[model samples]
Target: MIPLKDNIPSRRFPLVTLTLIIINTLVWLFERSLGPSMENLIFAFGVTPADLFQYGLVSQLFFMTTAMFMHGGWMHFLGNMLYLWIFGDNVEDRMGKFRFLIFYLITGYIATLAHVLSDPTSTSPLIGASGAIAGVLGGYFVLFPHAKVLTLIPIFIFIQIIHIPALYFLGFWFLLQIFNQTFQGAQSVAFLAHIGGFAAGALLVKFFQKYRY
Candidate 1:
């Protein structure tokens, strides 16, 4: 399901969310400009669990954060940023800009660790903001369960845009992550990371909630 928008409105400008989207776009542009050097860049910046064994502490830690800002392809980038655009604004609003930024980075790190725990020896490079955005969705689920998400769900020949409660939308999303992780056995997508990030955001949202405007 593609979320077109949410019913909830932000009281303040979503500076953080807009900033994130812009940063991601700029990073994507830089990655594209790399041309043949793209593979090298992704390897250097993207999180590889095996790198933990090879690189120094600082470098390994840096990879975890850098991986979130990188993307493997245009579709991968768009899907992640779309989720962030739909849900991140309200999350930023609730947590406030400074706190929300902290929450986002921490949850993303947790998400990366989750993938690492899944297979610590794997050399595959994990990249993209889906895991971090999954954290945002988890927080949204906790904070606005009843809010309606206008989703574009395709069925047969017709694509339908329907309003789904945030609880169900996010619940089903989390479930899909688990389901794929359990049965699919990790093809290309990082299911474990999504599961971990979602759990972190859902559990941590209450503590992070602050009215700073």
Candidate 2:
């Protein structure tokens, strides 16, 4: 299911969300410019679970944060940005700019750590914003459970558009991650990171919102 938009409107400008999107876009463009050297960039900046454990806290922090802004391909980049554009605004609106920014980074870090812990021996470099965007999805799930999301469901040859509640939509998404991780066993995507990020966001959103806006 692809989420096109949501029913809940943001009361405040989603400056942080927009800025994050811009930064990710620019970083992706830079990655494209790297051409043949893009592999080098991914190794340098992306989080490799085994290598991540061998690094110092500073270097580990560097990889965890930098990885979120990078993408593996056009599909990866566009999919993440679409979800962020659809769901991130309301989350940013609820948490305010600074808190939301902090929340995003923290959840992303936690997501990376979750992936590391899941398979510390694996050597693949994890990239993209799906994990962090998963956090935003989790926050949206908690903050706006009743909100409706206009989703695109492709049923083989036909496409169906339906309004799904945030609760069911995100719940299914989280479950799908688990299902993929359990059965698929880590193909290219880091399902554990998505799971961890979503869990982190759901657990942390209330605490982040407790502070004065």
Candidate 1 on 89-113: residue-level lDDT in tens? Answer: 9999899999899899888988988
Candidate 1 overall Cα lDDT vs. reference? 0.91
Query: TM-score of predicted model 2?
Result: 0.95
Question: What does the lDDT read for residue 91 in candidate 2?
Answer: 91
> Which regions of candidate 1 fall more than 4 Å away from where they truly are?
53-59
Clashing pairs in 2: none
How far out, in Å, is residue 80 in model 1? Answer: 0.5
Q: Runs in model 2 with CA error above 4 Å?
A: 210-213
List, residue by residue over 1-213, the lDDT tens digit for candidate 2.
999999987788899999999999999999999999999999989888888788744668878889999999999999999999999999988888999999999999889888889888888899989888999989989888999999999999999999999999999999999999999976588999999999999999997773233
Error of 2 at 109 (Å): 0.5
Clashing pairs in 1: none
In order, the Cα lDDT scores of the candidates are 0.91, 0.91
Q: For candidate 1, report its TM-score.
A: 0.95
